[model samples]
Target: MSRLSLHRRLAFYGAAAILLALAAAAMGLTWLFGTHVERRAIAEMEVQLEQVLSGLTIAGGRLTADKLPMDPRYSRPYGGRYWQVQKGGETLRSRSLWDETLSIDGESAPSGDVRIYRQRGPGGTPVLGIERTVRLPATLRGGEAKLTVAMDASELTEARKAFALDLAPSLVLLAALLIGAQLAQQVYGLRPLKQIGRRVSDLRTGRASRMGADWPDEMRPLTNEIDALIEERAADIERARFRAGDLAHGLKTPLQALLGEANRLSEKGDEAAASAIESVADSMLTHVNRELARTRMAARQSGTQARANLAEVAGRVVAVVKRTPDGARLEWTVEAADDLVAVIDPADLAEAIGALAENAARYAEKAVRISARRAKSKLTIRVCDDGPGIPDEDLMRVLERGRRLDEGSVGEGLGLAIATDIAEAARGRLTLEPGKEGLCAVLELTAAGT
Candidate 1:
């Protein structure tokens, strides 16, 4: 599965919460409106019941309404409006009741107070009603009677449905606006993180040395820590380079003294002892040079705004190599464009390339070629020679320090190992492959402006 970004996660959760809240609001509004409609309906029924009670009279010893309620629905069958009166085994109902009646409990309510109820009405539909039991006027034959007026409960239900339908679009629009505002807030909040990322990239590429100040308050602690770490790392690398230089210089004098002793042994006619001492001194010198080179290369890698021209470095190495006896016997070709550049220190680039080119010139039978090209964000420098290349299995072993395939060679086997270390320090690599004629040494480096 793909990872979700911070913005996407925040948007998802925010939208969900907004929708839930709006849905709840919609439900609550619809319920409140339904309760309001029911209350108004019951209040209207109370007024109708009062009118029916006021119009009642005793004629011929029977109860009769001299006047009925004013609503026209009272005259229509099942029109959702109704009235009923009952006294001493007599019952009177509005025409809207038709042959049906409002179901009522046998227990009578308290006098002079109206009570609300819910029960099946005409045609088995539910209705909401108000009831009052009162004593008739003394002049109209004093007796108790129950009066009820009801309206169909379905009216309140329909009113609630209508209210929800009307509210849905507004609720949807509100949710959308809220969600949009939340997304904008999240983007604004996370902008600092993006800026920090770009600044860190600049630091790595040597465009900037430190994470500067004036960050948001929430991000100050983090930025300050990163700046401190970068400073400490640079200081540490500088100190290491100083120590390495001191160690190398201090050992050089002793190595020279050993060489002087070897020469004296040779003068004394002890050739084998002089040869052994010379070999040991040479080996120690080689190790010192290799470490010193590695330290400097690592310092360059830490952070340096240095750009080296590929063509220039290649030409310099070629000119130096051509002065050697083996290079004089071979043809050297340089095939790099002058504009091609890499993000590496000029001296470091020259040293790495010179090591490869010198090795190639030493072994080439006819010709040595130096070429470079930029591919995407990488700059590759290739040095090839027209000589017998090493076997595939021995390619990796040859890069190891002091591991020489041919011990008869004059120099210690540190050239290829030093070149490899330089490449690694610069976040690159060196690889050996079979060329069209013989061996190919490829140095891959980071291209400038990548």
Candidate 2:
């Protein structure tokens, strides 16, 4: 039922309709052929009846036919052709009838008028018959004689069977051609829908911007509606992203003022109050940064074409981190191939890698290593640090926004959380695992050109 595709459904219905029509056609043709055969048989019998009437004579006061029909069957007994003439209790019949006779109904009719009927003949087989009552001339004692000529009805039946057999192969061939044409029509008709499906997939993957207008008249309205919906959805997302950016920017000045107040408190020698104010300001700023990262990820997800070289983005993050105080003291290694590219915005990729690199720099006792590789359809970037790694139980907890294992760390603990959001938006993932001598952050994103 419903599981059948449109092509299959159309093929089924078309083939069924063709078969039914052909079946009806076969029957109609067979019937017409049978009617034609019967008419031809009756016409021949009419000619024989006329010949029988013309040959009628009274010889030795008995009715007899002096001239016989030319067909050879009339000379053979039970040859399926017959003629008879009867008048005044005297009867004359063709030799083909032998001692048997045709059975006719006793219905009366006008003289010289011919009638056609179905009745039993010699050997009790069915026969198609033509009969007439003819008036005798006055030279002889005037009287009317009934004449009949018949052939076996089975011959007509056999002819019809033969005709159908002859017609079968041609009809079957016609049905095949018709069904093939129907399937071809279905494939041609549905090709547009397949193209629409592929185009819609391209839109989802940021490969195409619109559904386009090159469609059949029947499909134009549907494609137009889909394109309109896509435009409306994109407009709505753009507005929402703008509002989010405005809100994040609005909160930034307040958080900076709070930090400024904290610095004044420190100058006034209120150390405890300054530390508390700075903590609150840093925490609020972290939240704002997290929101901005989310807004960027959302915009990337809304069908923006994005491709970033893994090596380039990783190099940028490492170079920036190297300038930090903690990063300058640690040995840093970057091991990414230049050819490896990921399907994500270059800016988003840089920010995500920066978060991981900064965390590695802050905690590494001796070394921080960044490496990337491309495998089939995915890009894997790993940032490893030779530092005390978090326990397995706390690994999942660290990815939650604002959750930190150590309160003394300068970061407010949104780095991994923001990175995770960006990875998921790119149809990838972020995972943390224990490396040989430290924590390893693995960021997997979709590979470009895959």
Candidate 3:
């Protein structure tokens, strides 16, 4: 789905709300004006009825109404007000009625006072008729009957129209002011979001390393998270670059030694000895390739992830080793919890644990013990064996690159050194310590915060 821009959405919603409020206010004003006009028209009509009633009289047993005092407003023809009177089905209307007779619908009203509504005259003007049954001096009672007084309502219609016209401009002005205020509020509220976008762009262009934590409280968590991700990616890249350079440097000497040996063998003119030397050089090259692979793996695995579980890695390594002839006869015990984790890559941790397990299998009488525990921010994994432990003097020496205590062992002296190098790159340490009954190797890595 396509997304609407924030500014446009804000403007739209603001306009809608303002329009709704204005419409409600306009309706309310219209209603109130209409009510006031109606009340005033009724009051004027009531006054006209009273005047017409006062003018009533009976002369010679014939009822008659003289020219009543009228409002100046209804003096002209169709000037918006008019009056009419009816007696015994005969009607008398103002000149303002314009030669049209007043027509009232419904039956004749009852005695006392009654109000009858009608539309009358040529213009079909609204009329309110007030009727009174009169007993005129007993002598005229048989001849004269009821009387009605009415006034036209055209003035109220004009007043209502005028009110609408006058109120329209004010309502429109209020709506405009409200819309402007809403727009201003939207701009002010979104200023912080705009700033955040600009800062993100700056980071992409390398103009800034982080969005400094000076943002509003609502935005602080987002800024901090972005900074953390950037820092983590930078650290990963730096470690990869260093690992590549170090691996290249480490391989150069072995490759040079192999080339030198080949050159020497070619000059000696001893075919069998030269063949043996070539085999040794090939083996050294193979070992160098393995170490190079290990370095690459280590570099790829470095990240700001939670640590690998030491007990889990040790169990996996031992399971694999159990298939081997020497490993089949050995006993392994892992004392760490399954949930225990360290701040190291799982693959790197597995490799380190594998190396220690294999070494223990090679030299141990029967059993090897792997344990993990946390101290402060560091997690330590110790691998102990029931075989002859290293002497105190050589314990530190065994950790050196290409140095092995047992010269009789096959393969290049790289397993321990490779594991140790990986640990160091991960900001960890590996050390050899004298065990109670054998050698104890300890791998210490930082623990990720819970």
Task: State which candidate, 1 or 2, has the greater lDDT.
Answer: 1
lDDT of 3 by residue, 127-225 (tens): 655655554455435544555555655655676778888988998998899889888998998898999998886554333557899899999899999
111-169 per-residue lDDT for model 2 (tens digits)? 87878888777887998888888888865468887888989899999999999999999
Model 1 ranges with Cα > 4 A deviation: 1-12, 57-63, 86-92, 98-113, 120-124, 132-146, 165-229, 263-272, 292-339, 345-347, 364-370, 384-400, 403-406, 432-440
In what order do the candidates fall by lDDT, top score first? Answer: 1, 2, 3
Pairs in clash, predicted candidate 1: none
Residue by residue across 391-417, what tens digits does model 1's lDDT show?
Answer: 999999999987888788878888898
Rank list by TM-score = 2, 1, 3
In model 3, which range of ten residues has the least summed lDDT? 298-307
Residue 4 displacement (Å), model 1: 5.8
Error of 2 at 448 (Å): 2.8
Model 3 residue-pair collision total: 2
Lowest-scoring 10 consecutive residues by lDDT in candidate 2?
296-305
Is 2 or 3 the stronger prediction by TM-score? 2
TM-score of 2: 0.83
lDDT of each: 0.87, 0.86, 0.73
The TM-score leader among the candidates is: 2
Name the runs in model 2 displaced over 4 angstroms: 6-11, 61-63, 88-90, 99-101, 106-113, 133-144, 169-201, 206-210, 213-224, 295-305, 315-323, 327-339, 365-367, 390-397
**Residue pairs in steric clash, candidate 2?**
none
